[model samples]
Target chain A: MTAAAPTDRTRLRRAHERGHHDRATIDAILDATPQCAVGYTIDGAPYVTPTLHWREGDHVYWHGSSASRALRACDRAEVCLTVSILDGFVLARSGFHHSVNSRSVMLFGTAFKVTDPAEKEARLTAFIDGLFPGRTGMLRPNTEQEIKSTTILGLEIAETSAKVRSGPPKDDEEDYELPIWAGVIPVAMQAGDPIRDTRNRDGVELPAHLRGWRWPG
Target chain B: MTAAAPTDRTRLRRAHERGHHDRATIDAILDATPQCAVGYTIDGAPYVTPTLHWREGDHVYWHGSSASRALRACDRAEVCLTVSILDGFVLARSGFHHSVNSRSVMLFGTAFKVTDPAEKEARLTAFIDGLFPGRTGMLRPNTEQEIKSTTILGLEIAETSAKVRSGPPKDDEEDYELPIWAGVIPVAMQAGDPIRDTRNRDGVELPAHLRGWRWPG
Candidate 1:
């Protein structure tokens, strides 16, 4: 794992001291979650579109409809893309001090639409392969016309920050005397039993990697 | 449940038919998730801030630091607030068609700051209690000094819409015959064992509600 690059953009809040800035920390949070809320503005009105995103090094990639207004505005324009995962509920003695454990990343940069045909295909393949791993090899590739109709946007990790809050909540000393339940409820995302497509031909065995997929903690 | 108010802004997506417009659907999705990525523009740059949010009837409220630049710009400005829950992973025969079962609500409205002290306190209490039912009554109320240091912003549900994708993935009829694995992996957030605060005073019984608190599905 690469050490987090020191920059003002990556500062964590005092309450978010558990938040990690290292490359591995950022990648872990991003990889565990597949969707991101892409935020951009059009004519001064803010818009957030939830889309599937895959990470490649410091860059994040997402595709939208050819006619998406938000995508058009994001092309070469500054955008904010955020991914957040709720880890658990934090029950605290004090109401004002209650909080949740979460991992979130906010990247501030300009997005450039990927236009090269071959590059687009590779990135799209990378996107699918990142989520499904070896399964990408078994699928048909994208056609030129299909690739032409999709718009892929990439945002370089220039000024990025990750804020995380973990462990149990801290309560005021006086509030601790109050009878209240307090603890952290751990949340997780796990893979379930594979469902074979009804129309799948006679006997293709499930890939080894996909059969028992488990995300590293 | 109130019928979805018909408006151009609240209309469901044409391409996605399962998206719902009922108020119960919107509120349930919003209430189940406690955090939202608030998108706004400051000095022509886009910023997305993750903050805890709560819904009251058709209005949604969120708060941030009194000194937050993003909060200041968003107050009184048209903003987009989005809350999303990733329910499951959707595996399809085609890579391009792979998706996730998700519930998302997008609100387009102007946000206004709560200036009245009494109203602000009430709203803040409601926000906290909404996340942890019955916890507010057990804790100390916010003082004038504390209230003055927080900024609360509210967005009405005048122009809002929700989109949901559930059940199995929709693969192309032709691709269904491909030799592949396909199905949904259900994801959820659950509670864990409570950790007693080290500073807690002796003999304080845990509140009954907190001990068995479970998020409504």
Candidate 2:
């Protein structure tokens, strides 16, 4: 899938070498984690709210309570949505060169509210079933009131750039001779055993979607 | 240590019950992970940049290349810094109730550039040693040019709030009786074995800091 080219807003100013404009790189980083922070302006002041996000085709979506002021402010307004994953710690011989290995994608665009009730419901269902496929069909259908109380927002994949840093620290040639231990301490997100709710009905065994679930690090 | 009260911006408008104003709650969420996204405006457009951050006393600090335009825009400007950790996935009987367990803190304040060279150096050292403890002392000291080429910015924790959601899914009473599975799949950040720099001189064993280092989450 072709991605939008880097715009002035998405261009990397500092470490331009780490910037990637391809859709493959951007989508991988976006799909690796459901965690994302959406930054938008409310009354000309910047507010960043961390929320769960998912991607469908070329658009990324996030949702909140319909009454959310943050969501209201984002509708038809410019927004910056970022998805990041900490890869590892890059320990170097000097403090200036010390850094963390990470993968991140920063998308710049206008966020519009998913106004159509049917589209909103379908997108919300995709969000849930995206993580645990087939589970959404098994659950009780969402009521009209439930759908009305939620708001989903989406942004196209234009004006986006992905920055990634990995491998050992890059230190000054002279500093490499120092005795300091320099390398990478790899970090990743992992899932522990599932904890069943006490109210769960008997004979409802763990489903296949979650039994084989693994965090995409 | 006491924290600042939630201002008009820091207060949780959606889930007021999940809001926490105490310093312990805010600091733990800040310290658990170094990953942070700094949101600030450039010519009325919001930009969120992911970077490593460390807290000292009641202030949070992050640094970047001296030539960074993002850092320049943030200096002494209204900015929002957020740190978040994804805890688990809350699967419920209905799509509306599906959620993720997470801890996040959003801090709003003006970020000031650390101009004092000595203080900047000390804070940079603290950023490194904050994770590995004593390893900063073992590394070659940062040179004057290195210090001159970095920009360190800090923001006081005067208006901040921590939002946390954990445990099993909270579904409607009638939905809970459905056969769909409901539970929480706990998630955490884990560190793998350290990889030594290929350029290391012979006999430089893994230091105690890296050997015992573990992600706080």
Candidate 3:
């Protein structure tokens, strides 16, 4: 895949070595995580809301209550969707060099509500199956009113940038000899063991997908 | 001691029950998360950049390279800082009710660079001590050159709102009786064992505070 063209909006001014404008890198970061923070403005005031996001090829989608003000502002304005996964905390011999190991993406685009009933239903089904494979068939299908109450926003991936930081902290040359215990404390955002619903149907097996899906360490 | 006034900007348009404006709740969420996504506009284009954030009282600060375009644009423009912690995944019997148990804060205010030499140094020191406890004395002090290359933006908490979703997913009354396995898969972003730097100074101990500072489970 070709690298995304670096428009004025997507260029990095510092640590340019960590910046990547390639679709491959951006797509990888988006796929690894399901949560994102969306930034949008209303009457000149900016707001960032954390929401669940998923990608299908070059398009990304997120949904919310149809009555959400943040989503409403997002649909009517240019939005920035950012996804970041914190891998670890970097400790350096010098205070100045401390950082974090992370992979993140910033995608700039506009979002619009997914309004078609059939399309929304299919997308919502994809969401369920995306999280728990083959489980959508097990649960009742979305009701017509349920589809109407949800707002799914789709943004074509354009002007995107991905940044990655990994490995040990880079302390100043002289400070490396200092006696501070410097290293990284790995941060794992893991999904713990599932708690079956108190009212769950008796003997329903935990699906394999739910049992296996975990954030990459 | 008083609640933040709910204005047109901070009011929730949906699920008003989940909205909170008290400074105590807002401060609690900010204290727990180390990362935040900042939203700001430059020439009518919106951008969201994730960076490390810390709080001291009602004021919050985040830093980046002084040459960063995003930070430069942020210093002059209005900004929004948002922090979110996903506590668990809510699996409801109905797809429409599926949500995540999370604590999030959206703080809106204009950001200005912490330009004073002594003030910036103190705040940066606070950031280090705040995260690592009594480690600043162990690490090499920052050189003046290092201070010159960093830009820290401070935003006083003026208009902020906190939204929380916890407990089990609130399924429709009828769907709860369905045969679907519905419950929460608890998610935690925790620190793992520290990996010593390959070139660490001999016998430097891992400070006790570093081992103990963890988010409430």
Candidate 4:
């Protein structure tokens, strides 16, 4: 497991035990979640926008409208990408110890635009195929105009960390004697039955990917 | 509906139609979700952290460990708080129209620490009772020490906006004839059966609040 070097920005000041700097742990987190929050600053104020993210090897990519102020600012500034999966809520006897069990990743790097058209197309196809193994061939190819209107940014896995907490709550020794129910109430992002579009083409079958979609198993 | 004044910071450069400046819309979105992402800057770099959030009247509050570097920096800096609910995935015939059906709220303001002990305690209790209805009475009250170890930051909804999109995908007139399955796959965050702690006291029954907890309904 190759680990990212601890820079001043990536160091964990609190809960250092739960922090991991290895790429193996970071990749596990990025692969499990499709959504992420991007942090960037404009005129010294910070903004976080939620969007879809995908990974390939040691790179992470996300796209937004070409006119997005956050995206345009981030392309030229330092940014942070964070992805989180809330596993469960930990109920403890003491309010101090009550917390959530989760897996999360934080990465800091400069985001640069993917200017090459060929590279952009490959990444776009990977975004679809990664979620649906063989659905790329079934859809119409993206037009040149459509590609021009979108902005894609890529960041290397240069400085990153993963924090994971699982299992029951850790209450103080004295608090355990209280007659209070304490345990974990597991939470999940569950996919429900698909709602076919009212305008779906006739005789179109439900693709295997959309029928059984899930994240962070 | 009270609307937030549009400063350059709160303006929507892209997807202008989806942006809403009304307080009625912003509060409704904030009241429905339990979590939010906070964006703050340190040494000119931006970081986004995910944590639980609660709203009271015109103010929003989030708590963190007193030792957290992000919270310490945010108490003095300008911050952005964003909440998002991923309702469904929009699958269109052409990739350009593909999007997600979601309701999100973003607020830009300065966060200040709640230094008064009494106000902090009351807000803490409100956080629990807000979700569990009547469950606060069943648990032991918090001690002074537990309160001191936590840091609570409050931000007013002075400059805010709510963005929402729902319904089926909007396919192009020419691409509607393509033989591709297109529609929304409804997504939700759901609670499963609560797992009793291995150290739960004997004879403790699963509380009604825990048994039927739902979000942003």
> By DockQ thresholds, what CAPRI class is model 1?
medium
* Candidate 1 lDDT over residue span A44-94, tens digit each: 678888887888887889996677666888999889999887777776766
lDDT of 3 by residue, A1-217 (tens): 6787887777876688999998888888898878899988888777788998888777899998888877888895799999998888898888789999999999888787888999998888877677667767767678888889889999989878888999999888888777888899888788888887777778876777678657533
The residue ranges of model 4 lying beyond 4 angstroms of the native Cα positions read: none
Runs of candidate 1 exceeding 4 Å displacement: A1-24, A177-179, A195-206, A215-217, B1-16
Candidate 4 local lDDT, residue A186: 82
**Ranking of models by TM-score:** 2, 4, 3, 1
- Per-residue lDDT of model 2, residues B1-217, tens digit only: 7867678888777788888989999998999999899999998999898888999999999999989998998998999999989899998888888888999999999999999889998998888888998888888888889899999999998899999998889999987788787999999999999999998877899998888779975
Instruction: Considering only chain B, report the TM-score of each candidate against the true chain B.
Output: 0.91, 0.97, 0.95, 0.95
lDDT of each: 0.76, 0.89, 0.84, 0.84
Clashing residue pairs for model 3: none
TM-scores for every candidate against the unseen true structure: 0.89, 0.98, 0.95, 0.97
DockQ, prediction 4: 0.80
DockQ of each model against the real complex?
Answer: 0.54, 0.83, 0.74, 0.80
Winner by DockQ: 2
User: Could you give me the TM-score of model 1 versus the true structure?
Assistant: 0.89
Per-model chain A TM:
0.87, 0.97, 0.95, 0.96
